[model samples]
Target: MEIRARGARRPYRSYRTLIAAACAALLGVLLTPAGAQGAPRGPHGAVKVSQPVYSYADSVRESVWVDTGLDGDADGVSDRVVADIIRPAEPARQGRKIPVIMDASPYYSCCGRGNESQRKTYDADGTPLSFPLHYDNYFVPRGYAFVAVDLAGTSRSDGCADVGGPSDVRSAKAVVDWLNGRGRAYTTRTGTTRVQAGWTNGRTGMIGKSYDGTIANGVAATGVRGLETIVPISAISSWYDYYFQQGAPLQGSGPDWLANYVESPAARARCQVVQRRLVDEAPRTGDVTALWEARDYVKNAGRVTASVFAVHGTQDLNVRTKHLGQWWDALADAGVERKIWLSQTGHVDPFDFRRAEWVDALHRWFDHYLLGYDNGIERAPMADIERAPGQWSTDRVWPPRGTDTTTLRPAQGPVAGVGTLGRTAARPGTTATFTDDPRLDEEDWAETADLNTPDKSGFVTRPLSHDLRLSGSSTVTVTATPSTETAHLSAVLVDLGPDTIRDYNAPGEGITTLTERTCWGPSTPTDSSCYRETAPRTADVTHTVLSRGWADLGTYASASHGRPLTPGTRYTLTIDLAATDHVVPAGHRLALIVAGTDRGLIQPPSTTPTLTLDLARTSAHLPLVGGARAFTRATTGAAPTDPAAGRSRPDGVAEPRRTPPIPGESG
Candidate 1:
């Protein structure tokens, strides 16, 4: 493992120029004077650092059917998942093996991938003519094979889509096994003509966004042998968390709905039974069942041997932030080598927001992990975070280094309409109550902070003298008495002030695509490395919802099942809000809004129950970057009057759907 000189690198004007330079350098060192093609070599015989000496236009493109052990579609034979491959022709022709980069997805034939909504295009002989995204274009020319896998029951694959279940995971895992010479694969769907992945050196890296990335996480959790690393961008670690918040369902649709949406037209009739099972197993009660356990990757994190490069957005309401929060923590506990990038956008790919940097970082990560290059990427900062729109920062670890929990309790304010939040707790017997209102939401509560709203109780702190940074998730604990047997509670943490921030509610979800294109790799007749550039969309707002969470009072003791509560009986419910990294500027106040039925975010309970909170026992535990001392200093200033009364609505849509919308689908 020899270290390369980082300062010797320079940015090329175009990918073609970079490829030409790499070829000249390689030819000067290893190839014959006649320029005859041979096995790809890097100074020594090792596939250490990747160089674009291979031709993307001349890459070998083909497809194979990897057999999965399970028959998810109830067919007599085993299911065979399709893997569309594009690799450098030189290495394979000369009998020299290369590593692989795979993106196993259910979206290839349905919703498509990336900002351009590009799907896989095949030629007449069933060979892939154009693979979606730039992975094939860039990595294929850099001595790596790019595998675009269609998940079981989707696209040209056999079996049924299980929505992150065993079939979905096993379908992708089998491909890795086949590349390592363990699993069986065939050249045709029904034919017995066998195929072997002799071109691969058995080192693989998986990468994708959303559902595709979720597959990467699932496969990595299986501890597959050939997989060396994974890059899961805004992916889900647990399917239950995606559709449910604690014991409450976030939306009406379940995993069955998503399964149907991505199921191929040819397999719809055969996968009907699978869809029915998804519905039967996942009830509206949001209980943790065996079906959900199988889909949860975090629980099996200990088995993962692959290194991880996780990317997620803090404001992503579709897949939500808890997925990354929990998954990152699990990976850390298991002592897995990892890196992270946290953006300020909503359910967006990094390629759409930070293209050049993303490509370079991904290339370096794959080179170091899969190609076994000692490029010092692993020794660099572990976390790269977007502090503001277009503003970035790096740290050795996430949540900063010295983050600690700081508890803030609510007390009576000078004004009778609102409450005060500070280090001191309220009087022993003091209490505040709010009734359930299905129509109101976090936005409505944020607007009426100075008013006495019947549906919500607002608590605000005095004007801060210094900026206070919150680095991670916060917990809201409420000792409350419910008016009914069942109830729903929602807690929101808001930064009450005027500021300009990313417009995450916009049509593009914080990115405006431009007509100008940037080419990343070589081009062919149908497939090209060019894609539209994007700019960040920003908005001026009076306040921003930092984090929020929901909980079912009936399931206060257990998330597995609901136990009916006695009317008027006091019980403590702890709500874990989504993870966030935000700074409350000086002079702006921080507010906590506690309400029932946060309208579009979660489904309301059948019975509207009023909750009376014992203020002395209720508190919010915030993960503050500077801990309690910094908070005390920031809040030492004299109290100010309540914020101005106005609409103060933020830009973008009020509520994001459970699943992000596809190009032609309704949100």
Candidate 2:
């Protein structure tokens, strides 16, 4: 492509300039005019980011890269470049010393780089994942300037990636120095802040999700001086516990992900180092202590000098959801300002959020901490929304000091609707079960294991006749018996639809999908609760969310709240099935499905533990919203022929019944 600057006499000369300019063009979308705050969608109904540039100062253009010897990534970009400065944007606010927010993330390969493109086609409808952001951008905009830096040896930078090791730690620090440096350096005809803050006012912070988040936490542990505040969302604290040994062989995600995004020298050379060893070695169960200790974030959590606002989805199988407790404790012990937000959200995405909001929040945080701007971040809630019973709440701490854990039970048979091969329950006398490998052919190894399905039979309280907002963490415990190696369980709290419920986001696209459907993927945590550890385990999988926290800055309690289940209206709490979303209304069954293997879903850990399940004493402990009763009758989102049968849930008392686990033999 012939390249030219916005104002130039000739085409741009350097590829560095070209790439930086393109990134400036792309990442600069945060500059869009302030009036339209909601997510902008294209004609196809996907997120649309508008570009709005304020000033073009050419004097600040300069390149800041230090060559780190071990170049695992051979791309023209240096290892130090990848690890240090992937996409460094200049301070937007003149001499005010705006806070610098830098984050590193694993990029999906666009052209043979091990990076996996969840959003391959720019089209919203066709993309496997949505949005233009790497990972930090998904929610960073609520209050921060998100700088997505590729770790060493990954993309267009240099050196081999250390996957959160010391090399990565030092490189991350180098980038931090570059961000705060107010010193002078080379300038380009093109107005891009490639160099010099040049010396910063010591207002620097690191934030990121997943892999990026892992590094953010690691660097924080090193007691990096320049590193200030951090928001490590869905971080991989205990790598082995969360990545591999959690309960599966090959830990489907880490392997498939490395295969798709971090596989080799060319891939490594193209950017930074390939994660050759991190994802290469197969995880050996019962022997994961070595790996876990190696990746132990808690080891350094206490040493981290920077204050942190940590958030984790209860259902994040990819990361140890329990890390929140440890990280929080470490921060507290270190006397570092600390905060926590846990939710029934998943490794998927936190609802009640828009990209811009996330960006805005991170900005406010950096401004307040890094640049010393009193952005009011500290005044906001310290902890909030592990799950709202129809409305959102803000607290000073996680699991808030005075909060109580309530229980909601399953009162009906687990299965009723779709019985496999004509059987409703796996009766004691019959062999009833579904094989996972047979269904593996249809699974998406990338995200399925972290989020899979075990045939579940359950029900929700009757839907409310009126709309009720429910936002918070949720966990469902099932005493299931599996003849096979394991029993995978998935839970979803669907808004019994047909009632007008509105949130933001477009349809079909990745991020949009969460907002598009009245139904949500299992936004619960997969922990000791979600997964019972007894030989014939009775695991309780809990997932939760805290929308209001420093990590997630400008949040209104209302962001996650949606209409609650209508009174007396029937709603179904589905357990196992393909990923699907739609409205289940009042007067209809709040359907809950339980099964063995689901299409396109990787099964949970398969360690043979055949056992019987008990029901009478079992129930989901949830914060039921007051003023709303169990749905008396529920409406199904099925198309009807009759004109009078309106698609609306009927209101009444909510009552959910749980049936005995179909006692069946392993066929």
Candidate 3:
């Protein structure tokens, strides 16, 4: 791939222009073409961007409402997604078409985005006076148009929010279509006047954090035209996974409640009927319904043509690591070009975690994808992962190819209650049972004790002889019989040892604000050029929960329907824990705890559940970064392998359900 140069090379004439431009830059005033008024053009006729070129104070700001053809609010008018555009005045006015960088978000008028939770500010005339964060202030002067859009039903948009459903996806997709002159938009909800994205080059890129980023993923899945690339930072790939994991309902409210909560009060009032419809569509069983399928980009990976740059936090309990890991795998299998940055921080943007490096990398990414500039980003490392807090490493591919999947089983320990995990399977008749307790929280479960009774079960391995890195999703398969009709089984992977690391889930953790600052882009008088410094908020932790998985026993056989388990009949339950990239030091121990009814994470059943595990058939398969040989060599002694390894039927039993293709797309 060659970098595209602007204009024809003119020897001495070009040299003189460059020298003159440099001299003017040192004087603090820039020289531009006779008709233009912003940044000066280069000798090759390209935008000459100095360090921090765009001034938010000087950029053009405007707004337009794009009609979405749906009367989501039932206000007798079609819904209109509001867009706030900021562009370099000179080039834009001079007819120099520029690529667009857009963020379609629902948080504009409410919870806000970024560390400071900045919201949209408006002038007296109802025009957007400020677009929060640094995109517009920094990128406009660099010859790009930065657009901040209000997802329909939020802020100034005229509609009802649908969470991650069709209305939400279409709100962003329409903007991309409009940029390419293929969609209809208007200046008002009921106005006859139409508006077109006349100044754009028709190529667009979408990016955001959280729900904003979720819009980008949803829009890209539509295979919409003009959407060239996307940078989804800690975004949700499947709304189903966001609310429910492996049939376990993680949160109390469903999409209907979420949709109403994100909308304006007026919108909620006007769209009450729509809200009811949403509630009717989203069931409480946590099944993967068609509603979720429509919102799942992972299911439509084949429809994607836009290149993806994914950023995620390994410790993000809100969206979790599996959301990105499973989506990334689908993108890879679909032959999508992609790059990723897997951080250790919890639900954070890279700009906060690694500012300077993030800005430089993002600049090159936009230049290559949106502006069609070849900046060698395509040749860079495919994955950058945090091995430990403040420590990072790069690899050609995520999870690193040829990873060894080591399956380990639980063996009764010398003590009555405690047990040991190793490569060897336990005796056929051995069993460990746990009763469900709806009152126990995650902290209670993490601090395992009271094993004399059956509220929970715990299994641990001896101190590792060598450092081991777990790099991908771990699968836990347990054969058991539940005493109750239904149960919610929770599986947790833990690092049991004394250590000091960032407590991502805790408020402020141990992070301290520093006096130093870093600049990302040009700032306007309102938004500054710099942000405060931040580092990991460390804490002394005796045991850290690395990953978790939950399964509703009723939905184990099929994710589409729920059925009570036969009273005394034993059944096989297999579930995949969230993915991770953590290094366990040589002296540390690894543990897996399986229990019922996690009170904090999900709504537990009213009646207690007693689960009796078939120790001979229960095993956890781990994706060790070290190959199988390395794991075996580091152990104290050789252990038995799975008797069903590589066979048509694992241990002579057939799969309960035609397991869906890893998360998204239908088989």
Report lDDT (Cα) of residue 380, candidate 3: 68
* Candidate 3 per-residue C-alpha lDDT over 1-667 given as tens digits, one digit per residue, 9 for 90 to 100: 0000112111110000001010111123232211122323357764433333544567778788887877777778778888889887777667778889999988877666666567777788766666777677557767889899998888888888888888888888888888899888877656879888888988999999878888898888888988889999988888888878777777767778667667877777787877887777778778777788878889898888999999988877667777887888788888988999877777778876766556656776787798776445776667777655665566667667657788988767788988777788999889988888887855577787324246777788776655566777888988888887888888778877677766675553224445455554555445554555567677788777888788887776886667777766788878778888776655567887888876666678645779898888889989886666645544543222431221121111112121111111001
**All candidates: CA RMSD (Å):** 10.1, 17.4, 12.8
Give the winner by TM-score: 1 or 2.
Answer: 1
The clash count for each model shown is: 0, 169, 5
Residue 346's lDDT within candidate 3 is 70
Report the error of model 2 at residue 7, Å: 46
lDDT (Cα) of model 1: 0.81
Task: Give each model a TM-score.
Answer: 0.88, 0.52, 0.85
TM-score (C-alpha, index-matched) for candidate 1 = 0.88
Sort the predicted structures by TM-score, highest score first: 1, 3, 2
Pick by lDDT: 2 or 3, better one: 3
The whole-model lDDT of each prediction reads: 0.81, 0.38, 0.72
**What is the lDDT ranking, best to worst?**
1, 3, 2
Where is model 3 more than 4 Å wrong at Cα? 1-55, 449-453, 509-517, 637-667
